[model samples]
Target chain A: MTALSAAAERLRIRSGAYAGQTAGLARGHVQANLAILPADWAGDFLRFCQANPKPCPLLAVSEVGDPALPTLGTGIDIRTDVPRYRVYRDGVLTEEPTDIRDLWQGDFVSFLIGCSFSFEEALLADGVPVRHIAMNRNVPMYETNIDCVPAGRFAGKMVVSMRPMAPRDAIRAIQITSRFPSVHGAPVHFGDPAAIGIRDITKPEHGEAVPVEPGEVPVFWACGVTPQVAIRTARPPIAITHSPGTMLITDLLNTHLSVL
Target chain B: MTALSAAAERLRIRSGAYAGQTAGLARGHVQANLAILPADWAGDFLRFCQANPKPCPLLAVSEVGDPALPTLGTGIDIRTDVPRYRVYRDGVLTEEPTDIRDLWQGDFVSFLIGCSFSFEEALLADGVPVRHIAMNRNVPMYETNIDCVPAGRFAGKMVVSMRPMAPRDAIRAIQITSRFPSVHGAPVHFGDPAAIGIRDITKPEHGEAVPVEPGEVPVFWACGVTPQVAIRTARPPIAITHSPGTMLITDLLNTHLSVL
Candidate 1:
C-alpha cells in the first residue's frame, strides 16, 4: 500500500479517519510528543523543557489559548491532530481519547516535543542496525540515575531508550544521531547499564526488551517519556500527553531539523 | 620558554640552531611526517596513500625534484625544514642525518603526511586528558590485524596509536578528531585489545604504553608510522623519512582543519 504524506496523515487524524501509530505512516517527516497544559503550568513546563533539552527538546509551543502550531505544519490543530491522547488529573491518568477538543480549555497551552523517530530514520538510512525495529517491538527504555536539572515543580530522573549494536555500529550511530539534537542527540551513556542504575537488562521500565548479541553493546539515548515522568512529579491539576507510540505527525522535514 | 612560531622553528632547523623533537615546539601549527622517494616510485606511493587514507593521510606532496611545499607554508624546504632525517637503502636504515642536502636528488618526490600532534593539541585544549602527555611518554602504538588496501608492493597491517579515555571523553575525542580528517581522523578501534589482534595491552609494537585506568578504555587511531611500515614492506632502492618524534612544522593553523 502507498503510504500517505505527512499532511494527508495529519488530515486523516484530524477528521477521525485514522488513529493508528504514526511510526511508518509519513516517512521523512518530524513526529512529536504532545503536551497540553493549563496556562498556569506552562511557564514552569517551558522552564523544565529548557533545563532538560535532551529529553524534552521543544519544537513548538502554542500561544496561550491558541491551538495552531503553524511552524510545525500547514493546518495543525493540537486538539485533533494527534492520533491519541491521555488526560492526567493530579498526575493520574483520567481518560484516553482520540480527540481532546471537548476537554480543551481557554487557557490551554500545547507543546510539540521532538521524537526519536527522526534520528532512527537517519540511523536506518545510514545502514546502522536498529534492533527493536527488526524485532518489531518497541525500543527498550529505562529510568536512569542521571537527574534532570529541576525547574520549579518539574524534577525527576531521566528515562533512556536502549538499542543493541556492535561497538563499531554504535560509533556510527553516535555520529548520525549527533546531527539531530532535537531528537536527543549523542548518547548520554553506553557500554555499562549498571552505571545508570539499570539493574536488569532483560526487564525494562517501559517498552519491549530486545536481545543484545554477544558482541553488541546497549547504547542509550534519553527518551521523550522523560517529560511525562516530570509532569507526574510536578503533580499538576490537569495535564495531557500523547499516548505511547502514537505521536502528532507534522510537515516539518526531518532533513531540516539537522543542526549541521 | 614561549613556544616558537612554525616559521621560526623551521628556520632554526634549517640553520642547525635546533635539532630537537617538534612536539610542543610550535603550538596550534600543523606538524607533518616526511617521506621522500625517487620519482619512479612516487606514482605507486601516491596511489597507496590515496587507497589507504586513514593511516597515510597525504597532506602535501611536492612536485618532482621540487623542495617547496608552498601550500603548507611560506617556504617549506623538504630538504632542510625538518629537524632530522632517516635515510634508508633497500628498506634498511643506512644513516640518521641532521640535514639531507647532499642526499637530495633532483628526481626525488617528497610527501608531507599528517601527524597526530594536531588532534592531540585539540583534545588537550578541549580539556580531554592525554595520558601520554601527562605521563611524559610516547603514545602506545600497536600493529592491528586490520589491513590497508595494497597499491603495487605497498601493503601491511595498519599501525594504530592508543590513548586511554573514559567512555564519554572518548566520545568527545571522536567528535574532535573527526574534524581533522587529514590527521588520521577518528579512532579505528576502541575498548578491547584482543578484538583488533593486539595480544598484550601493556606492550605495544612501537611507542611507550601509559597506564590505562580501570574505568578507562584504550582508543586507537591510524598512525602515520603505518606508511613507513608499508615502505619497508615495498623495499624501494632508496627512501628518506623524518626521524621518529621529529616533524616538519608548517604554517597552517590547526583550527583551519575543522570541517565544521
Candidate 2:
C-alpha cells in the first residue's frame, strides 16, 4: 500500500491486491487476532475471553452478521480486511482463504483479540531487545500446562510465547508490557520451562526456537494462540480465525491500547 | 508507638522508648536508609547516588551540620529519630549507638536513602508473599561483580538483596516495585545467583538467607547496602549510617512514593 494508514492497508487486503502476513505493516496501528464464531456460541466465548483476559484481551465484538468493527477501525470489513483467514469445521482446519465473504454467516459474531505486536513494539521502543524479532524468526510459543479458567465449552491449557533476554532487560520488559493490559499485559512466566510444563526449551509446540544466550533467561508472555487453542478444543460446529501472523490491522494506535 | 503515624514512631525513637528495627512500626509510612558524611565527601556521594539510583535512591539530602530534615517529616531530628546508628571511622565500624548527637560534626551532611521496606509493604499489600518476611529472617544480601558508577572517591561493586519468588509473583513484584522509583525501584536481576557473581546462595555477606525452593527463582533488587559498601570503600574520615534494619521513619506514606 502506498499509504501506511491502516484503512489503506485494509483496502489493499479487501481489493485482493495484498494477502501476505501483516507484520510491520501500517506502523503504529493495533493488529488483532480474529476468531469468528456463531452467535449461539459467542456468549460463552465472550465469557471465556473475559475470564482469561491476558491471553484473550477482547478489543471488540462485532454485531452478529455485521462484518464492520466500528470501534477498532473505520469502514473495516472483518470478512475481508484480514490478509488471510483459516476456516475450521468441527475444530479441524478446512481452508486458508484470502477472504471469508462466501463462508460468512448471518448469525456469525467476530471477536477481535489483542495481539503481542503492540507490546513487542513497546518493548523494542524502550530499547529492550526481543530475541525472535532480532533473529527474524517467529516468537517461540509453548502450550503450557497452566489451565485456562473454564467458561462453558471453552476449556484448555494456556499457550505462551517465549523471548530470551538478560534479567535486566526482562525486568524492564515486565515494566513496559504491564502498561498495555490489552496486549497480553505482563509476562506470565520466566526462567525454567519445566515449571510451566514445557518439557523441552529447544522444542516449542509452535513458532521457531530462538537461542537463549549464555546469560539470557527465557521470558514468557501469554500468547494470542491461547484463545485459538481454546476455540479448537471447544469444537464448535464452525470456527474461523486469522491465519497465523496475518492479523487484522486496525485504525487504533498501539499506544492507544496502553492502560497507562 | 501508640499510633501508626510515622511522626509518632519517630517521637518514640527520639524519646529512647523504642530502639529496635523500624520494620512494621509506622505501618503505612516510608522508612529510609541513613548515611551521614562530612561536607567535603557529601558532593561525591551525592553524585555516586545520582549515577547509581537503583541501589542508592537518594530521598533527601540534608544541609551541612543540620540534623533536622524539614522536607522529610514534621520536626524530624535525624540524629535521634532513627532507632540505631553505626559509627564508621576511616571505613571501620567503631560503635553502635541509639543516638549520634554527641558525634554530630558541624560539616556532617545527612543523606536519606529509600529503603526496601516501602516496596515490601507494597508487595505484601498486593498479596505477593515476600520470602524473608514469611520465614521471619532477613532478606539475603550479596555483593555482586557488577560495579557501581563511581564519583570522586566513591567507588565499589554493587550489592543486592535477594527475595525468592515464583515466576508469577516475581513478575508482579517487578510491576509493583517499578512504581516506587525512590525505593530501589525494580529488581536489578533475577533467576541465577551465579549470573550476578554470588558464589553461594546460602552464604550471604549480610542478612540471613532464606531457602529458595523448587519452582522459585531468586529475584535480586539493588540493595540499600550498596551505598554503605561504597562509603566504606570511599573511606570518608567519619561516616555514619543506620544499623541494618533500624531506619529513620518519615511522615510520607508508602503509597505516596508510587510514581503512577
Candidate 3:
C-alpha cells in the first residue's frame, strides 16, 4: 500500500479511523513522544528537557490550556491526534485511552519531544545498518549510570537506546545523526556496554535484545524514555503520555529537522 | 618559544635556518605531504590521488617545472620551503637532503597532499585526547588489507594511522574530522584491529605503537603514508617527498579547510 502523508495519518488518528502504532505509517515525517502535564509541573519538565537535551529534545511545547500544537502541524489537536495515550495519576498508569479530550484539563501543557524515527531514517538512507530494524525488534534500551541534570522535581538517571553495529557503520551513523540534533544527534556512547554501566549485553531494561555479532559494538543513543522516567520520578498529580510505539504523527518533515 | 607564522616557518626552512620537523612549529596552519614526480609519471599519480581521495587528498598540484606553489603561499619555493626532503631512485630512498635545489628538475611536477596535522589540531582543540600526543609517541601506522584503486602503476594496500580513544571521544573526533575531508576525512575503521587486517594492534608496520587502554577502541584514519607507499610501489625513475614528520607549511589556516 502507498504510504500516507503525515497530515493524512494524523487526520486518520484524530477521526478515530486509525488507532494503531504510528511506526512506519507516514514515511519521511517526524514522530514525537508526547507528554502532557499540569501547568504547575510543566515548568520543571521544560527545564528538565532543556538540561538533558540528548534524551529529551524538545520540538514543540504547547501553551497552558492549549490542546493545539500549532508549531507541530496545522489543525493538530493534541487531545486526539495521538493514536493512543497512557493516562497517569500520581505517576501510576491509570488507563489507556485512544483520545485524551475527556482527561484534558484547562491548565494542561503538551510537549512534543523528538523521537528516534527521524535519525533512524537518516542512518538507513546512508546505508548504515540498524540491527534492531533488521531483526524486526524494538531498539534495546538501558538505564545508564549517567545522571540527568535534575531540574525541580524531575530527577533520574539517563536511559539510552542501543543499536549494535560494526564500528565502520557506527562512524557513518554518527555523521548522519549529527545533522539531526532534534532527534538525539550523535550517539552518547559505543563499544563496551559496561563502560556506560550496562551490565549484560544480552539483556536490556526495556525492549527486546538484538545480537551484537562478532566485530560489532553496541552503540547507545539517549532514549525518549528518559523524560517518561523523569515524569514518574516527579510524581505529578496528573500526567498523560503517548503509549509505547504509538507516537503523534506530525506534519514536520524529518529532513526539515536536520540542523545542517 | 612563541610559534612562528606559516610564512615565517617556510622562510626559515628556505634560508636553512630550520632543518627539523614541522610539527608544532606553526600552530594553526595547514601542513601538507609533498610528492615530486617527473612529468612523465605525474598524470598517473594525480589520477591515483583522485581515485583514492581519503588516503591521498590532493591540496595543490604545481604546474610542470614550476618551483613556486603560488596558490599555497606567496613566493613559496617547493624546492626549498620544506624542512627536509627524501630523494628516491628506483623505489629506494637514495638521500635525505635538507634542501633539494641541487636535485631540482624543470620537468618535475609537485603535488601537495593534505596532512593529518590539520585535523589533529582540531581534535585537540575540541578536548578530544589524542593518545599518541598524550603519550609522546607517534601515531601507529598499519598496512591494511584494503586495496587502493590502482591508477596505472600507482597502487598498493591502503595504510592507516591508528589513535586509541574512548567511544565518546571517537564519536566527537569523527564529527570534527568529517568537516575536513581534505585531511583524510573521517576514520576508515575503529574497534577490532583484526577486522581491518591488522594482526596485532601493538605492532604497526610504521610509526611507534601507543597503548590502547581498556574501554578504548583503536580508531584508524586513512594515513598520509598510503600515498608514499603507492609512490614506492610505482617506482618512478626519480621521485622526491618530504622526510617523515617534516611537512611543507602552507599559509592556509587549518580552520579554512573545514567544508562546513
Candidate 4:
C-alpha cells in the first residue's frame, strides 16, 4: 500500500491500523506529548506548565470537553489521533490502549506538550552528533534534584535527557536548542551526573544509557517526561497521557518553533 | 581634576600617566585583549584566531607596523593605549611595561580580541549574578583536555573560566550568552571537573576558586587565555600582549556584539 499522508496517518492510528512508536513518522512535522486531565484539575496544571515552561512547554490546549485541537492541525482529534495512549486513575497507570475513543470523557482537557524530536532534527541537520539516535536507543533520562517552579497541585523535581558530544559540539547544541524554547530549550546541566543528583553515570532513571566516549561530555536537556512525574506527584483523580515514544504528530513545521 | 572622558582616558594611558588596570575605566564601551607579533607570524596567528574563534575572537587588526587602531576608537595607539603591556622574548615573559614605544618594531602586527567583560556586562544587566564579580576576584580558569581546532603553530587544549551557579540560572545564562557569540558564546562544560580532566574542583590553574553551593553547578566558558596558552606552546621569537585585566578599551557597545 502507498504511504499514508499525515492526516491519513492519524486516521490509520485512530482506526487501530498503525499502533507502533511514532518517532520518525510524519517527517518534518511537529510531534507532541499528550496529556489529558479533567477540567477541574487543568487550571492548576496549566499554571504548572506555565511556571515550568522548559519541561512542560504547552504547544496547544483543547477547550473543556473538546477532542479536536484546531491550532495544532486540521481536524486533529486528540481523543483518537495519537497511535497509543495510557489511562491513569488517581495518578496511577491503569491501561495502555491503541485508541482512547472508548475512554474519552466530556470533562477532559487535552494539552500538547513540545517534544525533543524537533530539536534533535535541527541538531542532526546542523552536523551535530546525537549519540542516542546513532545508537538506536531511547535518550537516557535522569531525575535531577533541581525543583520545578511549583503550581497548585503540581510539584516535583525536574527530569533530564542526556546525549554525549564533544565540548564544542555541545556548545553548538546549546545555541541551536536555545532557539526552540518550547522544546525544553538549551540544557539544564552537563558534564557531571552527580552534580544534578545522579550518582551513577552508567545507569539512568529512565530509558537506555548510552556510552559517553573519551573526550566527550554528557549534555543534558530538560525532558518532557518531567510533567508526567509532576502529575504523578500531584495524584489527580484522572489523567491520560501518550504512551512512551508514541507522540501526537501535528501539521506544524519544526522550524516554526524557533524564536529566531 | 575633572573625570577623564573615554578619549581623555586613552590619551592619559598613551601619555603614561594612567597605568593601572583598565577594568571599570571605560564604563559603557568595549575592552579588548591585545596581541602584537612580527609580520612574519601575523598570517598564521590570524588563521589561528579564525580557526578557533571561541577563545580568540578577533575584533580588529591594525595595519602592519602601525601604532594607531582606527576601527576601535579615535586616535587609539595600540602600542600605548592599553594600561599595561607584557613583553615576551622567545615566548618567555621578560618585562611588564607601561608602554611598548621604545621596543616597537617596523615588522609588528597588532590584533584586538573580544573579551568576556562584554558578555559579563550583558549578564549583569539581565540580573544574572557573576560569582567572580560578586566576590571581587578574577574568574577561576582551568586548562581542559579538550583541544582547539589546530592552525599553523597554534594547537593546545582549550582553557576555560568557571563560575558556579544553580542549574536553573545556568540555563538562563546559556541563553543570554548565546546571543553574543563574538565573545566566547555559551559555556563549554558544566557540572563535573573530572569529566574534563580536571582532578580537583576547588583548585584551579589560574584565578581564585570561588564557592560552589550545595545545589549549584560550576559553569565553564572558553577563556581568551586559550590563545596565550597556545602561543606559549608555539614559542615564537617575540610576542607582546596586554597584561591580564588591562585591556584596550574600544568605542563599541557591548550590545553591538549580539548575533541576534
Give candidate 3 regions above 4 Å deviation: A1-4, B1-4
Docking class of 3: high
In the range B155-200, model 3's lDDT, one tens digit per residue, is: 9999999998988899999999999999999999998888889999
1 or 3: which has the higher lDDT? 3
- Candidate 1: tens digits of C-alpha lDDT, residues A1-260: 12258888888889999887888878899999988899999999999999999999999999999989989887788999898999999998899899999998999999889999999999999999899999889889999899999999989999999998887888788888888999888888777788889999999998899999886778899999999999889999999999989998888888888998
Q: Which ten-residue region of model 4 chain A has the weakest summed lDDT?
A: A1-10
Per-candidate TM-score against the hidden true structure: 0.95, 0.97, 0.97, 0.86
Off by over 4 Å in 2: A1-4, B1-4
Docking class for model 1 is medium
lDDT: worst 10-residue window of model 2 chain A? A1-10
Model 3 chain A poorest ten-residue lDDT run: A1-10
Query: Per-residue error at A238 for model 2, in Å?
Result: 1.2
What would you estimate as the lDDT of candidate 3? 0.90
Instruction: List, in order, the clash count of every candidate structure.
Output: 0, 0, 0, 0
lDDT of 3 by residue, A1-260 (tens): 22257778888898999888777888888999999999999999999999999999999999899898888888889999899998888888889999888888999999899999899988888888888888878888898898999999999999999998887888899999899889899999998788888899788988889998888888899999898888888889999999878998888889999988
After the best TM-score superposition of candidate 3, give how far the Cα of residue A234 lies from its true spot, in angstroms: 1.1
Model 4 Cα displacement at A24 (Å)? 1.5
Docking band of candidate 2: high
- Interface RMSD computed for candidate 3 is what? 0.7
Interface RMSD of 2: 0.7
